[model samples]
Target chain A: MYKFLTTFLPKPLANIAMALWYFLLIIMNLYCGIAFAQGTFQYVGW
Target chain B: MRLLIEAILFAIPMILLAWTLPKKYVLLSQIIITALFIAYQSPLSFAILGTITFGNYYLLHKAVLRKSIKFVISLGILVLLIVSAKILFTIHDHWIIPLGMSYYIFRNIHYTIESYNGRIQNESLLFYLAYNFFLPVLIIGPINRYPEFIRDWQRRRVNSEYFSLGFQRILYGFSKIMIIGSYILSLKLSAIISNIDESKHWLKVYLETITVVLNAYFQFAGYSDIAIGISLLLGFRVMENFNFPFLASNMQEFWSKYHMSLTSFCRDYIYTPLASYFRRPMLGVFITMIIIALWHEITLPFLIWGSLQAFGIYLAFIFKDTPTSLVSKNLGRVFVFNYFCLSCVIIDYELAEALDIYKTLFFIN
Candidate 1:
């Protein structure tokens, strides 16, 4: 999967895709973090 | 929230210190940060951890220097007794087991065994302490080895590649925990299952069983990813814990890929020695499985779960030499996957509840 991304896509396009992916992850993390603080999200214990 | 907040707050300064300090002082910064974090979280646990760390270090040093079998045996038994006490205390709710006690003890056990074999190079008490209490792996671990960690420390360097990769890996870990495990598996799939009709009891049972196992995998693998990623950021390359375990086509393959560190530890320290001692490989397999089960919790369900896993591996061994085609390989994957999912019911529920689920799954009625 990594090879396909780095090899198949243009460097600039790959960079943009990577940045967007991180952005999406950060936004989702923020949402989950807030939900967790509000006691709506269940905790997964070790 | 408190734990998360504290971890982030501590991690920021810890990472900064690690980057700014001389390579030699990096381990010291980690030790201090870990001490602060544990003390802040629970003072009693902090005290307990400190005692264990220092005591084990003293014992290990003596064992290594004297090369005495007696010292090795005594130290091994002492650690086991502490772990057993922790298990019993957990069962009775009489006392709280110090956080990360399980992970660190296994590490201590690994260290002891290796030291006895004269494989350990760095006998530095400082390195041992840092290995035990390294913040990322202290809670949930890949159980990084002593030799590898020492090597990483010696060759540690500042690099942009490590930073980028570490950040990316951490993001992947959070995504697995938050989106995949918590939201999709725990909340959404569970809600869907609960809404199903009672008439489709078998379907509900199957789906719920699969979901439980998958959720466990994601939760564990996510924590491991976070731990490994943090280790990477510190310029240390720790062992990988999971490698697409669900894709494995047999019980042996699955065990090899899933929780790679712990299983490999068992293979090396538990299974190998026992197998050689008894001269009966199957007996060793059973005992190792039991130890693995007891490591999690000394409960009847866990014992049964471990036995079932051993039996699965035994069957796989019997068929080891059988010829395989593409169709057979796919079938094997499906069979192994379902077998694991169903067996997980034993550990996830009470005995009678698990029995009922099995009956429902197999159409016993």
Candidate 2:
């Protein structure tokens, strides 16, 4: 699946696309971290 | 969580300073910063860590020059400290946190072993303290080796690409922890697994088992990612911990992929030596897994889980010689995943209770 996606998109373009996805992930994580910090965001390990 | 805040508020400025500081002063600055962080956490803990650092340093410093029985004696002392700390601190008992005791002990032991083998070149007390207590990796470590860490410290960089990538990695790790690990896994799914007896349906049982196992993975992997990312930002190239472990096609591949550093540590430090001594890789594999398991938590359930893991790995080793087909490959993936999921019950439950859960998972109850 990853190979197919990369094959369809050019190398540099694919890199950009992946980087954008990570950027979105960062935004989502930041929102979650702040919103859930007071509620459910507890680390699950020692 | 408070530690995370402390890191952002306090450690980041020091990291930036250390990055821009002269090469010679960088290590000293980091050492002082890390020491202050530990001291701020607790003065007693700081004292304990200081004693450990001095003891390990003195022993290693002496052993290399003397070439006498100090090596064995130092190793024995470190092992004793580890055992005592393990017994003293249990999360369930709430006796003492033993803040970073496990990680620092292992780090010092690694330093001691490498020193005994003459693998380490610089035996500077400051560098040793800095490496062992490097504030970022101290909490959840990829267990960076002393030699590798020092090498990175000497030639650390702060290029645009590295800084950008490091920032992205940190964000990614935080996302994994906040979104998936804590919210989805812990809040939503683990709540169900904690009440497993409420469900009689096989599907629910399977779902709970898989959720619990994934919870364990995400929790640890998320922390590891954050630790590694933090280290990267601090201009250290710590080892990778997890590598798409859930996608592993076999148990051998799983171990090689999951917690790669710990696996390699076991391989290099424990398995290789034991295999050489016993002249059998199989026994070495069992012993290594048992040691790793007991190291996590000294209990009967962990022992059983470790044995199951060893068995899975052995099967993978045996199957490697056989002719492969796509069906067999997929089957191998299923077996490995299911084995790990089943074994993870030991993390939270006792032997009998975990066995009951297994029976439910198999629809035998």
Best by TM-score: 1
> What does the lDDT come to for candidate 1?
0.84
lDDT of 1 by residue, A1-46 (tens): 3456889898888888878878988998888878877889785644
lDDT of 2 by residue, B206-318 (tens): 77778767866776777777777777788877888999987788898999999887788889889999999999999999999998898777777788889999999898888
Model 1 CA deviation exceeding 4 Å by range: A44-46, B1-5, B62-65
Off by over 4 Å in 2: A1-7, A10-19, A38-46, B62-65, B90-92, B188-200
Residue pairs with backbone atoms closer than 3 Å in model 2 (clashes): none
lDDT of 2: 0.78
Interface RMSD to the true structure, each candidate: 2.1, 2.3
TM-score of chain A of each: 0.81, 0.67
User: What is every candidate's C-alpha DockQ against the true complex, given to 2 decimals?
Assistant: 0.57, 0.56
Clashes of each: 0, 0
